[model samples]
Target chain A: MSKESIILLLFIMVLFIIGGCQTQELNESGVVAGLGIDLEEEELQVSMQMARPALPGQSSGSEPAFEVVSAKGRSLSEGLRKITLLFPRNPLVAQANLLVIGEELAKTDLALIADSILRNPSIRKNAVVVVAREVSPKDVLNTQVAMESLSATAIPRMLRNQERQMGIYQEVSLEEFLNKLARPGVDPTAPAVTLIDSINGKAIRLEGTAVFKGREMAGYLDSRESRGLRFLNPGRIQGGLINIPAPFEGPGRVGIEIIRSQTKVEAANTDGQIVMRITYIGEGNYYEQTGEADILRLENIPVLESICAEQIKSDMQACIKQAQKLKSDIFGWGNIVYSQHPAVWAELGPDWEEIFPGVKTEIKVEFELRRTYVTDQSLHYQ
Target chain B: MLGSCYDLHEINDAAIAQNFSLDLLENGQVAFLAQTTQPVPRSETGETQPSQNISVMGTGRTAAEAARGMFLHFSRLFLWIHANTLFIGENLARQDLTLISDFLMRNRNLRFQTCVYLVCGVSIQDIHKAMNERGFAITSARGITQQIETQAEELGYYTPLANIELLERMLTPGIEPALPQLTVIKEGDKDRIVLQGMGVIKNNRLIGKLNPEQSQGYYYLQSKKKQGGLISIAWSDSPNAMAVMHCTQFTSNTRPFIQEGKLNMKIDIKCELQYLETIGDDNIYVPANQQRLEYLAEEKIKQQVRSCIIQAQQLNSDILGWGLTTARYQPGWWEDMAAQWDQVFPVVGSQVEVECILCSDGLSRESFRFN
Candidate 1:
């Protein structure tokens, strides 16, 4: 053959090779919707939840669904490999909406668990991190959702709701918790989740929060205190209120909540005292109505003011008391002291826990009930 | 082309051989006047222009000796800047005349820079005047103060999310109480000596000036408990007033080990005065019901304050001065205390007591009963 013909033959071969690789299915795969991490006693537990595609024009509806697979090994990567054995096709990459940690495993040791998270490149740092407070994380992941096609998509929407609400329940991003674990002054807190079983069977429930001081389970802030505990950073929340029945109207009570808060802390003497204040503005909606007094009466305003003050005082005290009991300055008090009165904090030395319980508090709260939300003093009066 | 090449070599040789001369301002110190980033036309000789604005702090005997302290201080600041590079660049890249006052307090070596402190020492009016003279718009820069937001995406430490606002990271303190850990108390009366350094901050700066009376007020404000014979005054009550003006109804339960059902918190509190202003006939008279109100306010105040303190404990927020209290009371407590403080605070068993002192409401308490 002539040299020109040989060159043309090579070009034709190149076209044939390119054509062989042109199908869209060969390049793109699938997306994962949810992930579950469990500790299998002696080995690592890993699970993946993916949204399966629906059949077109089938006799039955395509109703959204997902398949659950389990893998176990000494390490997360190895566990993933074991799980892959159960699937025919490769797991497609998609938005991972939720990550669930089993209660039994979460309580055992978090350091290794966190390491697995750090190593997984597919795992998103901001994926909702929840610890199964009572039920197994795998069980929580298994629950079916009626609204959404897949539980993977449904679970995250639930967590995101809580995130938008009061924002005290920290989202516990993998990166943030890890950063906090490494810092001495700062500690980590994760949302506690549980599977609740009613007459209808199991459902997901947000328990409260798990406080971690230095990568160890320090303690927990119950639901009420957790509401206030979450106020420490506010994270993504704009502002929220904790409705405590205000002591204004007789019988029925008004709902009072803090609309905004600001905190300042400092140390005075070397290792001596740290003074902090949660300066907040309280706003509320009236849940109670009484006929004897007008809600708009200026004289009644004092009653409303006192109710607001007491509520704030209670919230602030609950936060402090919890910090003292847990011995973990999860509120970043150590950082406050160090930043404000480093000299004094230094004198106290390394053991800040001992120095924390005896600490005194100076709290100041300001309240403004923007509106009564209604004009009528009472349902009976109206 | 040959001639040009020969000339280029001569120029390079001359630049390498010539010794740079300098006449630095010698004020017996090392002043690091930041070189303006603007480029200046080289003198006909193409020599670099000298700056006369750098004023660095120095503690050494010689100019070179002083350079070490200045450099050390700057090094610390540089590290902070490096750690928060993105935050700084996003927030303060445009702001001129950076004041390093609070920064100096943390690093005492920069005490000489106090005169240059801007946010606190200089009044807003003064700042306005200076800015006018400098031909800079007050609201020109887009700072966090202007952009109120809730969500912030992390773009390597600094997000466009309000770095100049709530989390501006200003290297100074603000108007609220400094962190009350190290209080400087001076003994005096009506025209009193100021007590500084509670370390309370507002807007990222320290405003540490508390009079003895205000200190007592601060204590009362935190405690929510009234002490015997301590007078409080509230002139006109408004909902928007600071905590200093509001009355509080304090409640608490101090039973030991009450974590389960019917967990009782020994609670008591009633509305009591939080502020005072000595005025004419419309004023709250100190002697009117002094004896009776004093007794009532004591327990009530204590309960209110304790509730606040306890709530901080419950949330593990540490809003109270417990760390300092422990540090002062039990300095070596952390050796064993640190391990248990978190668990101990929420369940600390103690006697709960409260009382409500009724001050003659200028508006009159009888008004509530009649209305």
Candidate 2:
């Protein structure tokens, strides 16, 4: 090689060496799938749930069969740093799927918890957030799942299932919470998680939603009200069963798994009271049929429709009753007044909770079963 | 030889390709809306001058009007970023409004005029129609409930204030007749619908009148193949019992644009369900006695299914999303309809076709009991 060529080759080698040394890994490492934040006395406690690689002979049947570590510090970030101090592996959260706040932590100053989560660069803004109700969030994070290996993945999936099947607490991610923390008249909700232990085994149960009027916890909606909140806030996608009464089968019911649902909220001025109208359209499949009535009959559809309406009404009532009793705005009632009818909201003044209790809400639902996969309209008996 | 060498060097320099910077095609008028610390003054000579930098207040008519103006003014800035743009931000924070609005207005020469967001107190749908009057594009935010709450918190007004109390405390009765504020009163079966964005159904059909909650459920069950969520259910062990629950999260990852010709909204839901906080039994079996588990499962699912569908229905209107759907689904429509989206949303046609497949019957199916 020529002398100049030799020099160029050396320069190129140096560039490659520098590039290799500076390159960062794109994949998440030592990522804890689930994390729990709790406050004890004056210290902040952080619990992390991470999935460890299984041994060659180890089975991956029991999910969240990983490792859990915890530490306490003056702050959430400090607590997290303490975790890294104890473990050789660097903690990562870019792929974290859930963040659980202990019930006590959620009550007073959530802004501190929210700020720490928002400031983290590796944390995903879309990660689901929740409030632990029945027990410490760490317990729920440590619960074993039969399918997924990480409780982080399992917990989020379980919550997502609730959204699809039943619109309860509308899903709120870290990014979403930040945005809600900035609005003028609306609030946000995060689902509550609890660890359920029974003779059968252990499972993570969805309790209800935690309501935040702003950055502060206003109150919590009971599960039924959470259902109403879900119905009122259809932006979340939920899948679940809706049952209707069957006339021919006495007290028997027919179950349909909801494939899709949407809601329209209207705030209007009528007379002197604030009138809120919530109209919804739902579509689902007749997943299970136990009654004598034929599923294929077009005429029977109307009868089924009537039954469905009654069911929805009762469901909505259950939600409304809970919200009213609790004096919480999990359904975004304040939002409706503030955004749609600001003028009225302005007049209602400071006692929104008091007015909320008396505010009239009318829920209207529309259910349609557009298709039935069954080919035969009637079961033929020879 | 020296002359030739110099010529060669010049030729090499001239041969370098010129970098191409794509410029946006300029079109339409730009309007500025912002909440300023000082009121804008119109000159006696009929001259309009941009006055005082707007602080972007959370409330007040000036703030609302200014935010609306700034959004229109900043349309150009967004157009520059996305040359063939439709929707822009789904839900921008209140603090960021001033910057974004300023950016949009400064780029007045851009092709598109719409700067759609999930929730921008002001509507851009009408501006698009007036300017482009042609086809347009749109964008949206996935989960927006948090956005609304965040906006309020950012503005320093997180709590829901009782309007009457505030007004009563602020102004004495002698001042101005407290304007008769518009309110929605619902008594018994009647709900006074406000905001033309509201939709009503009766017996599962679009019967002009606002259907009762029960009727609305019937409409959803009859029209769609799937119920969105379960709101209430009876434990298989106790057929007469009911539990109220809610979904905390709902999300869908179906990009219908890539998979199918139809524009589909994907959904996944998570809920916190409550039923008589004290459950007599957590593990209740279906088919309590001499009956199939499927029989009870069917009944329990149908009852609360309709209730969950309502949330979905409201979202489809593009109102709940902070106008994100309008920004995504119909950018062109949003541009044309931005001004009146609030009014038009209620009357907008909402059709969501569904297909639900049950994957599990829980422990009830396996442990169903029959006498």
Candidate 3:
């Protein structure tokens, strides 16, 4: 062959080689959007939310958006492979963004599941992890959402929205969770999910923060406690509201909108006694008032500030107390001592748990009111 | 061999799915819901109208069986590559999530970026009925994702999580997962889906939920980025007097130490804000008034942070990941106490320091006083 022909032949051969790999056509592969894992009767139950594409020139009016397939086996791999028996197309999980863990499986041992997920090369490491509360993962994957076409995608969006608007829960990704697990002093937590009865019907909601001891779950933090946990973390707070009794002698209340906040904790070895000094500073705007008090005057502002400070001091104290009661170092006090006073930690390390409950604390709070929105005067009624 | 078209598949032959949902029936069977978009033809002007959405339901003893059942009602093979959302019905979410996580991690066709949501206060059937009644298009998977991407940071309402992240939290030792919750509200004759707060998961079970306020606290604790939101302060002297500030910038720093053999943490937060609106006749531009405003803002933030901390302690859930900080800074002490860290967390004391700066005043420096 001529030189050009030879080159052309090589190019054609390269094309064939590239296309020769075991590649399934779009129609031959079932794309998975979500996956659920459950353990029942010592068997692994796996469910997959598979996408169903709408083809052109076909009657797609009655077709659904996706389908769910499930199988049971002794192992996760076996269960997933068994899906082929029921699903005609090869199951593909590379696109899945949501993973649900059954309550039983999460309680038993997540090490095996973690191993399987980490070992898998095709799985994405950024998928959102959730624990099914009082429900099975299969059922979660099967539910429909009114706002979004798929609940799998909508769920994560909802989490993001909650994080931004409420600042009550943190979303943990696979990679971030693994990093925390591998760390020494930190315990892992995951968002809990459940179904609830609403006026429209049964809906999905994120309920609480799951507390973990080692690999197993220790307990959970209710909404209030969860917010307290966020407060302990210096920068976790975004925006929230604080309601305080009107800083005057009246049966009224004032609502403050948080704009910025910071917390500082110092551990001092004062005269052989461990004392934790917590200073919290915050900034916000005047939001609402429920009583007919002209507390907006410049003279009364200082009193309002002090009252708000008192409220904060009490809240931090309560959070600390709750952590003490749970016996879970969700606050990392032990870690704090170890880092700040290595010598002291060395002596008290073994007995840190016993020493923690007796630790003394001093709290100082300062608040600043930044701006008044819209108007500068209260409504004067006849 | 020459590249052949032996495995060629036409787009017209496949069913493109946009959303997937799972529900548990009272009969112990799993129900699957799928929402697919139909291909729309172009008009004579070469413009295509919106595609039609179709819904299909299937039920079976297992997830795989239910999926197979979907084929009975439909003729085309289901394609999941484009599907990006999954919904868990109340019954299913309350039961367990193991099956879902296991299936997702092992499957090759699934993407780890798909979002997960828990259905609360409503059933999948109810949602379907609501959609049918309104004749609304259910292709909102992209819309929800877009909303989260565009608004989450500014709104401070929810945190978005994907499949791999959820599994990692369950499998990881130190941190836990917090998933976003969803619920439907009936407005007039229409039903609207809204994001609630978040669910706290322990050992893969949903134990409780964080309200919107608590959820905001959670977000604030972990957020490092500059946030945009409104902070409103109420005047104690006047019931109807209020002031609102728009947060322009925020930063938080934490310091952990051992003082007097006690574990203590020091936190410093700084915020920059703009004066937006007020309900009372106060010239905040006056130096004294500005100082007062700053104090009020600081006090409000301090109180909010403190309240959040108290609430967390009550729940005994360390969504704060404070343990990680301790472990990193004080490895020696953490080693001995890691096993019983839970016992040490509650008593840990903290100090918070906050500073607020008012950067600007909207349009007019003086309040609009009526004669």
- Chain A superposition TM-score, candidate 3: 0.81
Local accuracy of candidate 3 as per-residue lDDT tens digits, A113-204: 77778778666678888777888988877775433445676567556545533445666777766656655444566777777653334556
What DockQ does candidate 3 score? 0.01
Where is the poorest 10-residue window by lDDT in model 1 chain B?
Answer: B13-22
Model 1, span B234-271: residue lDDT tens: 33343332112234332332222243521223333333
Could you give candidate 3's per-residue lDDT for residues B120-239 as a string of tens digits?
888976655554444434426555565554446566566677776666666554445677777779898777777887776654556666777666556555556336556788866677
Candidate 3 CAPRI classification by DockQ: incorrect
For model 2, what is the alpha-carbon lDDT of residue B12? 14
TM-score of chain A of each: 0.80, 0.82, 0.81
After superposing candidate 1 on the true structure, give the runs of residues whose Cα lies further than 4 Å from its correct spot. Answer: A1-30, A55-64, A92-94, A163-168, A198-200, A234-236, A239-241, A246-249, A257-271, A282-296, A342-349, A374-376, B1-371
DockQ of each: 0.01, 0.01, 0.01
Candidate 2, which segments miss by more than 4 Å at Cα?
A: A1-29, A54-65, A165-170, A198-200, A213-223, A234-238, A291-297, A346-351, A375-382, B1-371
